[model samples]
Target chain A: MDEKFAAIGEAMPRLLDGLVVTIELTIFGAIAAFILAVILGLAAASPAKGFRIPARVVIEFFRGTSLVVQVFWLFFVLPLLGIDLHPMLVGVMALGLNYGAYSAEVVRGSIQAVPTGQWEATTALSLGPIQRMRRIIFPQAWALMIPSLSSLLVHLMKGTAIVGFITLADLTYQLEQVKRTAGTLFTYGVVGILSYFVFALVLMYFMNALEHQAKHKLGQGKSLWRILSPAPPASTPAGGAS
Target chain B: MIGISAAFEWHWSAAAEVLPTLLTQFVKVTLLVTVLGTVIASILGLVIAMAIRVLPRPLSEAVKWIANVIRMTPIIIQLLFASYAFLSLDLITIGVIVYGIHYATYMSEVYRAGIDSVPKGQWEATTALSMSTLRTWTAIIIPQALRATIPALGNYAISMFKDTPYLLVIGVVDMVNAARIYGGDTYRYTEAFTLVGIIFLLASYPTSLLIGRLEKRLAYKT
Candidate 1:
């Protein structure tokens, strides 16, 4: 028992390093994904096939393949093609592209969920497309997308673990090393899962807060405390394709 | 890392030669794993969602927590645990179980959503008609719920198909595994991995289109 505690104590610092890497990868990957999702998702919903087709193809290509393959392709294959990126860059790109494809659907769905009348009202006011989408449609849609986007973000964070296979030394890799040296597979496994759960909860808390603020701005205000509480059973969506 | 300059060259002949074997593995292993995984996930997910709905409050809450933990954690961890805990199990069996259970968590949520979409009036109507519990669920509720659930389940199936590559972590000879090995031998990582991506695209893209069609057909009907 003494030895187990000592080993855990010793492992904490190393595990923290891995946790930092994981968090960094997730944040960068998420930012990239959000950018790609917004651009491609809007293109997909656009009237012109020229824009829509390419966006659809890109989204479909990313969504169809396994993320592991995409990451491996980036990490291993890209060098052969003369693109020598750091493992972190590769991890972020692969994760961003893959999850971005899924998030595109969320973006499209939420944007469509904006009342049809709003689009008509914008048109009636003779607002340009960009101006109307910026001022009116996007704000409303962003609120509806929060729950889905939060779920996708959690999935992307979990995906950071897979980057370890490409030698990123993320939390999973760190935990695996700890498990090996400590001779405590079960203990480390429990700790690793709990860490991920805590990260997810933390993420969800912030996302809900964002949702609360967005809803409030849109005049559908709810208590901040209500938003901070975990999504009740009826409201929670699936963990998605992760 | 070996002879880095020469390794960068893409040899067309070798890629052509390796293509058949990769396709064979794609069909025999990758597709098989996905089909089996989807079957297990669908049945288990329904059972779980049903249990959560029907079971008493405390038990259901406990089940929800377990499901959430399973759903939220990285699947690689679960795969590793399965590899360790079920040491006697073969890779295919282990792969199917892990993949199924991992996705089953999502599927359960999909099921829950479908069940929730069923109107309260439907339930009250069943109760008024004095339908038995089994009949109420099996006949009315399940059928209606399943219509809403099919597209979601199909999406999960496509996701499972792509994720079969992770089975390689457990040493299962999945499509990605086959690609990596071929690449290792030739050091032509570019062709092998690119081909693997292309094959995945070929398989999943059409299926997604089909699912979109299914979703459209089922949308207003329900």
Candidate 2:
């Protein structure tokens, strides 16, 4: 027990470093994925076959293949094509493209889920396609997609573990190192999984708050402040004035 | 750049030589793990969902917490941990079991959602008829729940299939591992990884389309 505690103490800094990398990968990859999702999703939902077809093909190709293969291909094969990238870049790009494809479906679905009456209202108001999206359509769809997107974000964070395979010392890799030193799989395994679980809980809390705020803005739900505070049912019932 | 290009080129001959090896490994390891894992996950997940439903509240909450922790953790880490902890077991066996249990967490949620989708009326009707508990579950609830769950289960199976490569950490020599070995031997990563990607796309694309269709059909029935 003493030896194991000593080993854990030695492993702490390295594990912290790995956690930072994992967090960085998740954040950057999410930004890139969100951008691609919006673009490709809009294109997929477009009436124009030219835009929709290409977007569909891109999404399918990325979605159909395994992400590890994508990461390996980028890391191993791209250098031969005179496009050498940093390992971090490779990790972020692979994650971005792969999860981007999945999130694109979420985006398209949420957009489609928006009431046709809203679209009709925009059309009746002589709103252009861009205006219809920006002013009325996107805000509603944004709220609808948040729950799905939040889950995807958690999955993406879990997926960051694969970056360790590509020689990036992400949290999983660091934990493996600790496991080797400690010679106790159960201890480190518990620590590793607990860390990830805590991270996921934090991410989910943030996403839920974001979802509540988005819905509240649309006058559909209680404010985030209210949700966070202790409920006084008699004082302010649901949908009641603040 | 010029030097690297000279050193690395896609070889049809290399690909042809490795194709048989990859395919053999794909069948022996990758597909085997996926099939067995899916079976284990499906049955185990249903059991978990039912357990949570029938058990006392505190016990069910404990089960739910365990499931969430497993679901949130990375499969690669789980694979590594299992491999280390179970030194007596075959690496492939460990891989399948770990994958099954890990994914069973996600599948349990799907099962729960499916079971919840079965109407309260159905359960009340079963009670009214004085049907045995097993009869109520097996005859009515499970069948209706399964219809809603099948497509989602199919998606998770495909996901499990793709994740078989994570077993490489435990030296499972799955399709991706075979490709990696071939790449190391021939110093031709381009063909091996690209071929692996193509193989994955080929296998999973059709399955996803089929699932999409299945989902639509199931939705109509529900």
Candidate 3:
């Protein structure tokens, strides 16, 4: 009993260090993803096939293939192709790119949801496209995108654990080390719990705050949790996205 | 890491020897994982979703937290961690558990939506008839929830099938693994990998269509 607890105490600090790396990857990747999602979303909104076709292809390609392949390609193959980014960078890129695809759709949908009058009004008022998008549409679209974006963030955060495989030494990798040394289930169970505890608080706080902030701007506010809480998916439209 | 455009010429004999084994094992492994994972995920997801919906804040909050943690971690990390960390000897068990739990988090959210879709008056009507919770759930809640969720549930099943490839990382020798291994061994990755993916498309595309059909049937009935 004493030994397990002692080992856990010792292992936790080490695991925590790796978890910091995981969190670091997630946060940075999320930033990259958000930026890319917005750009891709805007690109998809382009009326011309010149922009739209390639954007759709890129989105479909990423969304279709397993992200694990993308990560391996970035981490291992990219090095051979003369881009020797560290595993962490590869992890970030893979995650950011994967979520960016999903976010693009979210962005497109959100932008589309803005009342058609808003677009015409902006046009009649002689607002430039950028001005109209920035001032009139961005806020409404942000609300629509919040839930999808938050879910994407959570997925991205989880994806950081993959860095462990390329020998980048993250929480799961450390847990693997602990498993080897301790040779007990206690090590993994504890590590999983701590990870769960940390992520729960971080995700809850981050997403809840966003929900609250979005709700205020949305002008029909609810409790933060209530707002972020997954709504029952509206009955699947006969033509819901395939 | 290979390019999507890579084209490696393959010898006929090498193709003959490898393709059949690859297809057979791929089906065996994918089917095994999908069945076990779906059963575990569907049952657990329903429980967790309901628990999340009805439990006190702390418990609901904890379940949500746990789900997020599972949801965030990549399948490879968990697969590696689970396979090597505690149960190296039982590779398939660890693989199944990890994937099931991973999808379970996503599934719970699906189920939660299904549960919430049940109108409040249904609950009141059940109560008025003095039905027990189990009876109310079995007879009313689950049927309605499951029907509403046919398409979503099918999506997860297809997802699980597509995800079976992750087992390749841990050396399960499924179709993807077969392709990778054959490529590594013979330098003929193109035919093997592309064929394997085509097979996946064949299996999943039809299943996806079936789900769509099921969704329509359920919609009409409701």
**Which candidate's DockQ is highest?**
2
At residue B103, give the lDDT of candidate 3.
88
Model 2 docking grade: medium
For model 2, what share of native contacts is present? 0.71
Clash pairs detected, candidate 1? none
Best by lDDT: 2
Residue B30 of model 1: what lDDT? Answer: 91
Q: What lDDT score is found at residue A129 in candidate 1?
A: 95
TM-score on alpha carbons, each prediction? 0.92, 0.96, 0.78
Interface RMSD of 3: 5.9
User: Model 3: per-residue lDDT, tens digit, A64-118?
Assistant: 5556556655654444444579777888888888788878888988999889998
lDDT score, candidate 1, position A232 = 31
Q: What digit string (tens of lDDT, one per residue) describes model 2 on residues B1-222?
A: 556584368788888988998899989998999999999999999999999999999999999999998898888778878877889999989988998998899899999999999999999999999999999999999999999999999999999998888888777888998898888787788889989999999999999999999899878864
The docking quality of candidate 2, as DockQ, is 0.67
Better of 2 and 3 by TM-score: 2
Chain A only: give the TM-score of model 2.
0.92
Question: Please, what are the lDDT tens digits per residue for candidate 2 over residues A35-151?
Answer: 999999999998899999999999999998898899888988888788899999999999899999999999999999999999999999999999999999999999999999998
Consecutive 10-residue window with the lowest summed lDDT within model 3 chain A: A73-82
lDDT per residue for candidate 3 within B65-173, as digits (tens), equals 8787677656766676576566546777777788788888889989889989999999999999999998998899999998898699778877777677778657787
User: What does the lDDT come to for candidate 1?
Assistant: 0.87
Q: Name every residue pair that clashes in candidate 2.
A: none
Write one digit per residue (lDDT tens) for candidate 1, span A1-242: 67766786898999899999999998999999999999988988887999999998899889988798999998888787667899999999998999999999899889988999999999999999999989999999999999999999998997888887787888888888887656545644577788998998888888989999999888787657555578733534688541
Off by over 4 Å in 3: A8-17, A76-85, A220-242, B1-22, B50-89, B127-135, B168-171, B179-222
